[model samples]
Target: MDIVSHLNDRLLFAVPKKGRLYQQCVDLLKGADIKFNRSNRLDIALCTNLPIALVFLPAADIPRFVGEGRVSLGITGQDQVAEAGISVDEVCNLGFGSCKLQVEVPDQGQFTDPRQLIGKSIVTSFTNLATDYFRKLEAEETNGVGADEQTQSSKPLKTTIKYVGGSVEASCALGIADAVVDLVESGETMRAAGLKAIATIFETSAVLIASQHPTHKDLLELIVNRIKGVIAAGKYVLCNYNCPRSKLDSVLKITPGRRAPTISPLEEDDWVAVSSMVEKKRIAEVMDQLRNKGAEDILVFSISNCRV
Candidate 1:
């Protein structure tokens, strides 16, 4: 199809080639009905069903590409966006791959607060966020000092931030750093490495981001809406049931949907059919509640994709 030659005409969608979010991002695109094929040796794939090109790059590099307008859209971690310090518009939160960027010290260490690590050496991949956090703490400490004392001090001690591409947790044991700022999902890795989180710098999840100025705004919006629909489908389920007309008000209370429940007539007089979308996690309890409220023939359906 001469994909490379026609790339300029298609919207570029940067995706994580491999990492924690890679598989999930692939699943999201599939859910959105984006069809594509790649040789795997190639980093780019052209969607057969849409005028889009998926550029698989490192998750951390996505924000830079999208922010610089080199790509029209991307799915990457919120922490990556913050660390990149780029000016991309966050289209929507994908609500998966949730984690926290945190400050962690050795478990046996006396440091229990991020403030205690000021002026100490910290190793991290996220050099910018870590440096900014400690600098803010340093500024606060300086603000508390008397004006005369501040004048006498040579300068506020600067926190030493070292950039490590990986294995930040080993820095403390190796005597190279006092602590580390890293992403923690389950804390198992930190615990195994004899570390404990003192403070969370920020909680983050996968986010859909767009260039500040996209070449194809309409196409970008269409893909964004489709991805949002997939996210909504993952979090919710469609619930349908029949109930007495007199009990409709009560059933509505049990399943009060995102907006409102859909009601339909039934063959039996004084009876009605109801349909609503309920949170997937609470579907069990919702069904039980409806059954107790004189609802009958209850059913639940999984939503593959939805607009809302």
Candidate 2:
């Protein structure tokens, strides 16, 4: 598991050490056929099959490392990238670990809109994003677009934003802030704490970020393409079937591949073979339609990975 002998010339890839995103990132790498041994208590690991060395770090810290060129690439939440306020090329959306950064207030409070809590105190782990949100509100107020213009015209709302490490939802109940901004995977946690979301600051999911100063452009592009291939492969399946020549056109419409369905001549001159890629989720419905349209010998098989 040392892998150090092959690590010196590899591109550094940072991923979350422990969190909701850690295992998902590992799965994505494996799906792309990047092999590595993740030994316990190891901060760094080498991808034996690729020119990449993975650095395990906090998800929140991934953005900074990539931005500073300390790591050539990383995977982290879009919200974290915004919070870090760094410049990095977003390669692609991984489409997992979806969540929302929201503004929540106590259930019994009189708050009905974001404008209602203008001058009130808010607490959150995302202090910078919270402050930036307030600044935008102030600018909107100056342009006469904010509600309660007359009251807010004289001076911008001096909203107080406090930073907390964790349990931001408890801040309101403990009188630390009038409202709290935090990540919400489900409304259950907020409901349990007697709080409700008043506004969603931003939506987020895991995304691949690449350094602007990449030293290994070719390797980076290869990994990115492999990941894209894995993601596309998961969403689709291969559908192969035979259809009478007269019904070939109709059946082809039912299972069109990325470009077009593959058609081949059959031993029976009046029949033809058709093969196409269909979405896995809609395979049942697609099969039914093809059968009704005179398709025969239909078969659907899973694809481990594909380029298109």
Candidate 3:
């Protein structure tokens, strides 16, 4: 089904077509078992496993589709949502594509403080956020510098914000902008471009956003819960092992789950089987501790999806 056909019947889900957040959103849907097949060059695809239609759009436009109620849900970066400046409900964070919106200056420039570039030009794709940041800073500076003749010399230090579609870092080198407000994932890109960040405006990550006027509430909640389950499973694992009853207390300390772990008597009188959920990152360390405490047959298994 296409976007035009799904306006009233099916839920339209907008995802990034190509960008840092594109593959992440694709993987999230795949992990949730929401399979989709599409014809070549088609912008819309119907999910084979769910009552959802996927619309491949530019990352910057996903928030607009959601806010305008053209789509039921969307997955895009928080920076995109902030730039769109729309009234949409943020359902959840998808936990990938994390980066910081930062203010960067040329390497040789002696910019030390955000206030130092008050009257300078800043270029960014996130024009809304950049404009708001400077407007607030200007207000604070104006209020703090009140009733002082010398300070009044710098009375209205407004930043000139210019919006660019891409290659924002080049604006500084090209002499079009004195500084830039852009996203920095590793800072390697900025450094290679001969720039350095002076101040971080905000951090952003991939987020699940929904239209404030959702047409399908039940399906929307189901999809959100399924995605949440997949995210939870990715971060945790089920750990099971046998430990002597005498060492249960020590082992429990290592794998104490959301609630107390399950402890059941084994065939042997003094041995017990323990099961618990452990964070994926800490599974190795927890197993080591369990082994040190005389646990045996320790197993770590992946969870496909989980509610808790």
Candidate 4:
């Protein structure tokens, strides 16, 4: 059987084959307990424990596959989905691979604003987004003008947006383009290339997306919940402690969990034990606050996986 025939009964999940999000996606799958062994030089992987097949493709292509229903699910950057202009359901934010799509100019150039380079050439992989941004900018400039004047002012944007698969930053240095629109994570790479950001287009992060109509809707929900569990596990920890009855109200305020903290009476008079989930980043501060509130035996435990 060919690949399509093999996947006929399995839900197709598109993942980035190789890019900034590839490894993080793989780790997420592992954390969700989706067992699979990808063969050497093959783009497809069959899950051993589920009726799901992983289709390895470029991050830019995953959104198209999911949006078209060719793949039931996908993990990709929100910017890719926007650039594709595809209709799909955003399942949840995975909270990694965060970056911003920015309009940048040469650091030492006279152009300091995106509007300054409006009529200049821009090179970027996100051609559609770049074109739309510049078009909107031009429209904004003609906002208060008369209809005829606006029409005259909005002649085809003098700004030319050319698509370059890579090396977008080098376009300015090579004199082929006056500015570039690209993804910036730390701003280090752009600085190294002598480019500075003038305007931010949008912020994006890795997102789990699903087809508008999934063939295996039930299975897709199961997988989505599992992925959410993995994300929650990474973000929070279980906090346990004992507090006096008089301090219960004050202590609960410090560790207000997803819901209410679980409270159980202790054998000793006027004492209660509390268990709650706290953000991993704020655990130390929460512990200190609990201690100050007359709580004792405060302990933090890592969560491997959970439904909430």
Candidate whose lDDT is highest: 4
The residue pairs in collision within model 1 are none
For model 2, residues 36-66, the per-residue Cα lDDT tens digits are 8778898888777887899999999999999
Per-residue C-alpha lDDT of model 3 across residues 38-68, encoded as one tens digit per residue: 7798888888877888899999999999999
Compute each candidate's TM-score over C-alphas: 0.92, 0.87, 0.89, 0.94
Error of 3 at 150 (Å): 24
Report the number of clashing residue pairs per model.
Answer: 0, 0, 0, 0
Q: What is the TM-score ranking, best to worst?
A: 4, 1, 3, 2
Q: Write one digit per residue (lDDT tens) for candidate 4, span 16-75.
A: 999899999999999999998898889999899999999999999988899886699999
For residues 117-218, write the lDDT of model 1, one tens digit per residue. Answer: 887899999988887677667766767533443343346448899999988889999999999999999999899999999999989999999999897888
Selected candidate, larger lDDT, 3 vs 4: 4
Model 1 spans with C-alpha error above 4 angstroms: 1-3, 144-157
Residue 286 lDDT in model 2? 97
Off by over 4 Å in 3: 1-3, 145-157
TM-score of 3: 0.89
Residue runs of model 4 more than 4 Å from their true location after superposition: 1-3, 144-155
**Global lDDT scores for all candidate models:** 0.90, 0.88, 0.87, 0.91
Model 2: residues with Cα > 4 Å off, grouped in runs: 1-7, 146-157
